[model samples]
Target: MRWNNATTGRWTHRLIPNLTPWLQRRHGQVDFYLTQMISGHGCFKEYLHRFKHEPNPYCDHCGTGSIEDAEHALFICPLFVRYRAEAETTTVCNLTADNVMSCTLESQSKWDAIANMAAGILKELRRRERSRRIQS
Candidate 1:
């Protein structure tokens, strides 16, 4: 299966083991936030540092000296704890890198809840990134 064999898009694969349901059910554009969360190729510090846009991959908000990869931003960042908690409560599922796909695919409401939460967090991250750039 392409799901297990692909080197990239592991995050996406984790959430969408079979594309049929997602393709058939999914509506509207994927949006900037969800694309970055799945592809790990957007404004994330780890991705930016990898591309030499950032000096370091560490999360400026968490203070734990952890790399600010998509997984960290999605699941572990205290900066977005409220958004994460709200999504969990709304979806009735514990969010995890491995389980996000399943949880989101559970229902239309679950999908909307997760997508909104992700958008909120990523948009804030993008805003913070832009502010840092302007200050520097």
Candidate 2:
């Protein structure tokens, strides 16, 4: 599905019933909330625009240079390379159905940690912008 706006252009997503549950399971509830906050659906996009960094809204770390969407925020961001690496390591041990289910069931704390980390990274990025502005 796609939604078009005069300012932000187009947004797209998969039309699947399981998408939300899958997101909550994989990324955790805090990440989901942060995604909603950033996307400005609960509020106005214009109001939320201040939170976004410039240069095409891509993954802050990877520089994928596209719209900064939820998937990129959760999985693909190069800034969270350490988190991804940890997840990869955990995946080896937690490769069973029971372990996967346990992880999903206990995802809230994990999500909180990730969300906090992301918030810190974003704050640092904004701080860098402030520094650059001062320098210039």
Best by TM-score: 1
Write candidate 1's Cα lDDT for 1-136 as tens digits: 3446365567667656677766776643467777877787767898899888888899998754799988898899888999999999999888998788667777878878888888988888889889989988
lDDT of 1: 0.81
In order of appearance, the predictions have TM-scores of 0.85, 0.37
In the range 1-136, model 2's lDDT, one tens digit per residue, is 3223543423222212223455456445545434543343322212234465333444334555534444443345565466545544544332221233234444555445444544554454446556645876
Candidate whose lDDT is highest: 1
Instruction: Point out where model 2 deviates above 4 Å.
Output: 1-18, 22-33, 36-106
- The reply for model 1, stretches above 4 Å from the true place, is 5-7, 24-29
